[model samples]
Structures are given as C-alpha cells and as structure tokens.
Target: MASDVIVRFDNILALDNFSVSIPRGVVGLLGPNGAGKSTFIKTILGLVEPVSGDIDIVGLDPRKDVMSIRDRVGYMPEHDCLVDSMSGLEMVTYFGRLSGMTKEDSIPRSHEVLDFVGLGEERYRPTASYSTGMKQRVKLAQAIVHDPSILFLDEPTNGMDPLGREEMLELIGKIAASDKSILVSSHILQDMEKVCQYVIIIDNGRSVAQGTMASLLDQDMTKRRMTVRGSPKSLQTFSEQIHRDFEETSISEEFGQMNIVFINDGSFAMILDMAKGHDVQVRSYVPDRLTLEDVFIRSMKRDA
Candidate 1:
C-alpha cells in the first residue's frame, strides 16, 4: 500500500497508482525532472493530498496519523531550510524538541546524531559558515535526531563535489546498516546504482519499472553479450567469424568494439570459442541483460 499518495493538477497525474513495497536497506527513486519524483516524496510527507488512493505508513494513514508519522519518519528535504543564525547543534536539538524529546533528551541526542553524521566537533559552529557537505550533514543529523524507523532523503548529495558525494553516500550506507529502511530520490544514475538494492523508476508520472536489481536485469530473456576489442582489423575479423558461425545474431559496433547479441546459448559459446582461437582480446564482456535504466527506457518506449 502507498503511504502519502497524491494526484495533483488537473493536467498532470503526479502518481498513477504508484505503489511499491519498501523494505530495509536503500530503495532508489529514479526519474528525470518533472517525472513526478519530487511530487511523490511530497505526497508521502503529507505535504500534498491525493485525489484518489490511500497512503498508509506502518498501517496508519498519513493524513489521519500525520503527527505519529512525523515522529516515526525522518525526512531530509531537498531544499535548504536551515536558519543561518542557528548552529548545527542548536538546529538538531530544536528538531528533537519539536519531535517530543525533552531538553535533557534533545541536547545529548543532538550531539549523538551529529556525531553519527561525522560532524562531532563542528556541531557548535553556525551552519551559515559551513560548507555544502557540512550543511548536508547537519540536515541529515536533524532528520535522525529522534531515531525514526524510516528515512526519506531527496537529492541528499545535490551541490556536492565528487568527494563530498562519496562521503555522504557512505553515511547513507551506515544509516541503512542500522536496519532502517531508506527511500532516496536522485537523478544521478551512477550514484543511485551504488546504494539501492531495489529501484523504482518513474516517467511522465507513471512507474515505468520497480523491482530488485536482479529481477530487472532478468526481464530481457537473453543473458549474453560479446565485446571484441583490439585493432579494428582484428575486430572485423572476429565479427565475421561470429556472423558465419551463428544464424540468429545482431551486431552493433561502436568505438572499435563489437557488441554481438546471440539468441541461443550455442551461438554465444560459438562466438567465445572463435574469439579465443583468433587470439583477439575481449576488452569487455558482459551479458546483454536488462538494467534498471534499460527497463525504464524500454517501458517508456512501449507505452509511447
């Protein structure tokens, strides 16, 4: 069941029966801009109402149990909302208090959460002076101050350099390691591929694909890819041998490499055997299986 479901604007259906079962570890929401990724998160946060359907958070309706859900779910908003005057420590403590923790509980918990995000000593400094990474850390710390069961982070690594992005990714991994489920939205394909075990791809307000990585890859029905690399002459030589050996094969060549698609296992093995005999170095060999990106593209194309 979807929690925080929504359909906005008469012209646009933000979520069209968009439903997914989330479990522990990181679940990625991948889509291009205006693909309803942001709208989905906002709806789940109870920031927007759905025209139809229901959103249940751990069996409680987000609309009816907004307060309870707010306390149980931690969210790192996409935009910057931190007050410049407030120190990292003060900000986290403030959120903790707002979540129903007493002063005594909030203060110590703030430091712990900041430390967990790798901002221990810097927690006392004003966020105004912090770098983008540090501010992101503070935002993350505040979200987890109350130790929520689930965390929703939207573009957590936005505006970060490569190094900063890596560090933030590691911290997110740690959060997932603590046995809490995480739902993260990001447009960066490579980054999302690193953290999420399950992926949900949306396009034009519809869920194009949703499943585990392996399941998505298995959808293609064929699981074999050939890469012939070396001199262009050798590539051409090897490709001709493959074409002569297999009756049903499709070839796509690019950048001095040949991608051979074989429909049957016999043809796949035949190509490999021939390549070995010719002494051609296969630079890269991967199965032509589907990927999350592939499935996304294929599904969208099918619907179109």
Candidate 2:
C-alpha cells in the first residue's frame, strides 16, 4: 500500500485509525459531519500533528519536511479568509509570492490561475464585493497559484448553488485530467459522487471503507432497486405471479413495488424477458445504480 502512495496515516488507533492511500487522480475523502476528515487532513499537512503512527506526503515526512511538502501541495481551506480590500488577482499574486514566486512570474501566473478558475474578467474586483461563488473561486486560484502537484480541497462545493456546484465539479475534473491528484473532503455525498472515482470513508476518526465505487458497493445486497409505476393493480398482479412462481421476488413496503433481488448476478435481460413472457405490460422498469450514500449507510450500520 505504501508503494506509489502520496499520503498515508497508519493505525493511529484513535477513534479513527486514519489509514488510507491517495493515489493519482481525484479521490474523495467522504464522511458525515464530525467524521474527523478535516482533522486527518490537518494532521497530514502538519497543521495538527498526530500523537502516534506515521504520515508521509509525497515521500516527504510531513512533520520533518513540512516546507518541502507545502511547496508541492495546494490547499483550499474550508474557511473564508478573503481580505476585503484585496482584489482577486492581488490575493492570488500575494499567495504566489508568499509561496516563493517572484513578482514578474507571480503577476502573470496570477492571471493564468484566476482565468483558469473562471475569474478572469473579475480578477481586479475587490474580494469583499464578490459573491460567495466568486470568493470560493478566489480561494481555489490562490491554492493553485504555486502550481502544486497535489490539491487538498475541503468542501469545495460548499455554499454553491446547483449551477455553481456543477461548474466547480467540471473545474475539478479538468484539474484531475491535467495530472494533478485531488483529495477533496466533503460531507455532500452526491456532489462527491459526480467527481470521484475512488472514495475513502472515515467515521468517528476510523477508516470505514476505501476503494472504488463499484468495489465499495459490491457488498450491498440491494445493489439495484427500482420502483415501477403506472398501474398499481396490474403491477401488484404481476408481482404476485412472479412471487408465486419464482421465490426470488419480494414485495417492498417502503416503495410499494415488486422488489426483485438478482441471484448469482443475474442480468437485467432476465427480468425483461420474464416480464415479456408473463404479458405484464410493464409501463417502465428502471435500475437504481449503487451510490456513495448506500455505501455510507451500510458502513454506518456495520459500525453500529
């Protein structure tokens, strides 16, 4: 696990063991509120040192080589720290210079990053006059001004409307495509679901699950559940016939639908064929794919 690993927090054994590997590309650090996701990141960034165990970012010990790690890592903190008098470009340039960028390089790179984050025209506007979404973009621009290889984003979608969220997700996806690894910590499972291929779930400071979406959801008994509506009585009759003939079908009280669990990973074609043969006249059939929410709920149940 340590091979090709950029960050590792091994067996702290606190409430959360804090162990997971963040490979290249976009990986989500998913958890509910107070799940210690932020704390774990802070510990890794050397902001909050761990009491026991070890942590390394980019093969450099975060504690011993804090400066080296900071140089190569971009962090967009969750809190709002924009200065009222500073323009977006100024703020970005300031951070860039602080990160060791010379004035000549900082000025142009500030525009490049602000433009990359969709703040080109408004780069000169004071941050205090910016909207919430604009402020978020400013923070993002500053984080990437130094051109870090890794980005640690804390709730990048926070306070964003639906459109803003989508735009932010697209931007994050572009960053991932451009060869920078992103570790985004967020409580919003749906938002994270759209961007992350791999997820690391932590609960009460313990690593709950860490894998690809498919791998995490593979343990679910109900990987696919859908409701069919249009004619209640006909659906019920179809369901009853299926139950009477085949024992694999069960009625779901929650959704009031004929819930069928696939045995031995049966294909969807089987259900379609069964419906056609029975002359059920199904109005519609939809399959619900597994989501991060389902995996999180299952992990919570297992922990309980």
Candidate 3:
C-alpha cells in the first residue's frame, strides 16, 4: 500500500524508502523490538503522515479517502486497549458504530463477533474482571465487529499460557482461512509460521526481507542438515574423515548422534557414497529448510 514511503517522528525516521505491495493473503510482519513496525502501522491508519510519499490503503488514499480506509480496515494493537469499565459487548458495539454501523446493527454484530471469538458468555462481564486471554478475545472481537476486509493484528498472543497461545493462534488461523486478509505482527516466530503464507521482515526502520514464507525460508536449497545415528567413536571417525575430505562441512557429535551441516556441499551422491563406505548409519536426511527464527537472525546479521 506504500511506495518509497518515509515516515518520521520528530527527528527519527521510522520507515525509510519503504516500498511494498501486500497481496491478498495472511502476511506476517516480523521484526525485533522498536523496528518501526508500530510506526508503519500508524502511517497506514492515517495516524502518522508520511514525510514524503503516498499511501494507498486497499486502493483508497488515506489522505483523501479516510473513511474508506477506516471502514475497510481493522486493527488490534499490541498493548491492552480495552476500557476496563466497559463490557465486551459495549466496547465492540462502540467500535462497530465508529465504523459507520448503525446502533441497532452494531449490537447484533458485536454479539456475533464476540461469540465467534469464543467470548459470548463474557460479553456482558466487565473487562476489568477478565483474564489476559479474555481481554485479547475482546480486542479481537472489536476489531472484527464491523466485518472488515483486512485486519492488522499486532501481537495477538503477547501474554498467555501455552494453551492460550495455541488457542489464539488457532483462532487466527481460522480467521485467515476465511476471506479476511490479515497483517499479523509479532516476535513469536512459531505463531507466525503457523498462520502466515507470506512474511515481511523489518529491521531498524527498513525492510530486510519480504516474500512467500516457503520461498524465503528455503532460499538456499543446495545446503542441508543431515542427522546420522551411530556410535560416538564410529561417528567421530566418520566425521573426521568427511571433514578432511569435503570442503565447507562441519560435523558435531552428541549422544551417539552425528549432526552435519553442508555449508556449500556441491555433490549429494558423492557424499552419500562416502558415508555409506564409512559405515555411517543414516537416520534421516532432507534438504535444509531454515526456521523462521534462523531466517530472521541471518537476515538481520546480513543487513547489519
């Protein structure tokens, strides 16, 4: 939605030359703390104006088509934003009305969204009495009360137990499975991997990576990790021989298992033949697919 966008707060530039077009799907916004993620979201919501460049929120300019952007888009901020005195229904209904829904329509829609978010019974209870998970549910309910086409979910599973985190991630997966497109921002790489088809990685106010999740994580297909189960002595001897024979290879042994990384091993058949001849038991071997966390670290270090 932005092209060469530069957003600044006072003297600090939050987004520099940020040019990216979001496709229609669930996308992840990943970055470390203070990586200009919030600033970027605010700029799209029209809360922060770009110092120089244009913004198109779902085809409507945020400057001239404020209402269109406001109506079609939904946002659930990272921190707690619920009104303690208001019940879930009241809060969601209020946001629904703010989205241009009539009072009568807002009430039913609010209940529907609260129920959809697994908070139907808690809709009437005051938010102050709710747990962290319930509060998150309320926030999610309010964001979707108006049935927006796109949602900006910032840390939807910020503080929760394992079960709660899983539930929230599953709920997000369900939402993304529907027609609604979501831009989910979080530091939790596992949750992002679960729900996101595409990823946008940012660091220090600049985008370091953006592409399909599979393509980004599996960028280098030639290199791979191989695990072989065998005796320590056998694996040790095997490892030494391979290390001396192959270029750009490292082997580590632990608990009678061998972990090998082919940094740039060019020949798969030759390596397999060598291992077979050395009597190295092959437990499993597959092309290396870097985890999201690995990709984030490598990308940040590369950019740095």
What's each prediction's clash count?
A: 2, 2, 0
Better candidate by lDDT, 2 or 3: 3
> In candidate 1, what are the lDDT values of residues 144-226, reduced to their tens digit?
99999889988999888999899889999988999988899986767877788888877777777788867776876655576
List model 2 lDDT by residue over 59-172, tens digit each: 888779988888988999898989889999999999999999999999999999888889867888899999889989999999999999989999898898899899999999
Clashes of 3: 0
TM-score of each candidate? 0.82, 0.80, 0.90
* Alpha carbon lDDT of each predicted model: 0.79, 0.76, 0.84
Ranking by lDDT: 3, 1, 2
Residue 68 of model 1 has an lDDT of: 82
Top of the candidates by TM-score: 3
Q: List the residue pairs that clash in candidate 2.
A: 16-205, 16-206
All candidates: CA RMSD (Å): 3.9, 5.0, 2.5
TM-score order, best first, reads: 3, 1, 2
Question: Following a full C-alpha superposition, what root-mean-square deviation does model 3 have from the true structure?
Answer: 2.5
